[model samples]
Target chain A: MTIGLNAFLIIAGLLFAIGMLGVTLRRNTLVMFMSLEMMLTAVNLALVAFSRYNGTMDGNLFVFFIITVAAAEVAVGLAIIVALFKRRQSVMVEHLNVLSR
Target chain B: MADLLFYLFAGITLISALVMVLMPNAVNGAMCMIVSFLGTAALFVLLEAYFLAILQVLVYAGAVMVLFLFIIMLLDVGEDSPAVKPAKLSIFAALTGFVILSGLVISLFTDPASLPATPAFEVAENPTGLSANNGIPFTTSAKSFGYSLFTKYMLPFQMTGFLLLAAMVGVIVVSKRITETEPEAETTD
Candidate 1:
C-alpha cells in the first residue's frame, strides 16, 4: 500500500484547510499565529513530498529556505503580539481596532 | 510497512494540528503544535529527507516552539473569550478554503501522468553502475545537500542569513519597553 503523490497532496490540502479555519474562527492572536505556522508546515510537507517523488534536490532546498523564513516570521510576529499586548493588556484581535480608525 | 507508517504519521500530524487550533488555552495549543511538528518530522523521514527531518525537529519543535511557549508564558494570555461568537467571517473563510481545496484536488487528479518521472543519476562509487532502488543517485544525503546549498544555492543561503539577522534586530526593537523618563519628558514638552 504505497502512498501515492496525490494522497500526500490531499493530506497537505486538508491540513491547510484546518489551519485556515483556525485562523478565521479564533480571535486570540497567539492561536491565530500558531494556525499560520500550521499552514506553513503543510506547505513544507507538500514541498518535501514533491521533492521525494520527483527526485530533485530543488524542492528540498526550497524547504530549507522556507523553514528559515518561517523562523524569522515567528520571531517578528511574536514580538509584535507582545508589543500589542503590552499596549492594550490583551491579545484579542478585537482590541486591535486602532488601525481601522 | 511504509504505508502504515505514513498513515500513522499523517494521523498524528493532522490530529495534533487540529488540537492546536481547537484548544482554547494558548499553552495547550502550543504543546499540540509541538506534537504536530514532531509528526511532520517523522513524515519527512518517511519521505527519505533525513536531513530535513532532523532540522524540522530542531528548528520547529525545539526552537520555534520554545519561543512560542516562552512568549505565551510571559504574556500570560488566558483562554479566549466565550462571548465572541463565530461570525459570518468564519463562514466566508470556510467557504474559501473549501473552494481552494476542491480546486487543488481536481487539478491533482486531472492528469495522472503529468508528473515527471524521477531522474536517474549514475553512481560513481557503484562498480556495476547499478542505479539505486529509487532510480536516483543518493541526492538526499547530507553531503550532496550541503554541496548544493553552498554551490548552486549560495546566494539564497546568504540572503537567508541576512534575513535572520534583520529579524533578530526587529524583534528586539519591537519588544523593547518604553522608558518612563521619555514619556514624562514628552508630556512636559
Candidate 2:
C-alpha cells in the first residue's frame, strides 16, 4: 500500500491535465492565468518527486529557479492583464471582439 | 497510512484544480487555486522535500494567490457572464488534453511495462552525493539549498536577480496611467 514513483508521477500528470483543460476551456483571462499557474505547480510537484526518488538536488534547485521566475511572471502578467482590462474593459477573452481596436 | 495520505492530497489537488477551472466567479476560482497549491505543498512534504514545502506555501499559496486575488477584484469581472462558446479549436485542444491524460493513466497504471524496473529509493534513506562528487551532500535543508544556489548555480542565480528587477520595472511602467495630453493612451494595439 506504500506509494511509489508511478503514483506520484500519475498524480502530477493528472494535475497538469486538469490545468491544461482549465486554460483551454475558461473564457475569463484571469481564470486562464490561474490555470497556467496550476500547470506550473504540477510540474514542480513532478520535479520534486523526481528529486526525492533520484536523490538529487538538481531537480529541487531547478524548482527553486522556477519559483523565482514564476513570481516575477505573475507580477508582470497581472500588470498586463490590468492593462488589458483598462483598454478593453473586459477580462474575458471572448469579449475582445475587435479585430484591430 | 502513507498511501492514504498520498491519495488524499492528490485528490485534493486535482479536485480543487477542477473547481478552479469550472467556477464561474474569478474570486472563487482563486480560492480553489490556493487550496490546490496547499495540497501540492503537502505532497511535497510527503515526498521529503521540506524546504520546497515551505517555499510552496509561502511563494505560491501566499504571494502568488494574493496577487491573483487583488487583480481579480481590481478587474471586478462580471461573474454572471455565462461561459462564452469556446472556439472550436480550443474545444479540440481540451479534448486532446483529456485523451492524453487518459492514455497516460492507462499506460501507467494498467500496464507493468510502463513501470520502472527498480523501485525508487528514498532520499531520506540514502542521500545522493553531488555529481561533482564534492563534499556537499544532497539534503532538503534550507542551508543546503543556499550552498548549492551560491556555489554551483551562481550565474543563473544572479540572472534571476536581473529578471526580477526587470519584472518589477516592467510592471510599474506597464501599469502606470498616462496623462490625457499624452498620445500613448490613444494608440491601441
- Candidate that scores best on lDDT: 2
TM (B chain), model 1:
0.75
Q: Give each prediction's DockQ, rounded to 2 decimals.
A: 0.56, 0.65
lDDT of 1 by residue, B91-175 (tens): 6877687568757765764467755434323223222221454222336567766776676689999999999999999999998
How many times do residue backbones clash in model 1? 0
| Regions of candidate 2 where Cα sits further than 4 Å from its true position | A97-101, B78-80, B87-93, B120-137, B180-189
TM-score of chain B of each: 0.75, 0.81
Q: Write the per-residue lDDT of candidate 2 for residues A10-42, one digit (tens) a residue.
A: 888888888888887888888888889988998
Task: State every prediction's TM-score relative to the real structure.
Answer: 0.84, 0.88
Model 1 chain B, poorest ten-residue lDDT window? B121-130
- Model 1 pairs whose backbones collide: none
Can you tell me the CAPRI class of model 2?
medium
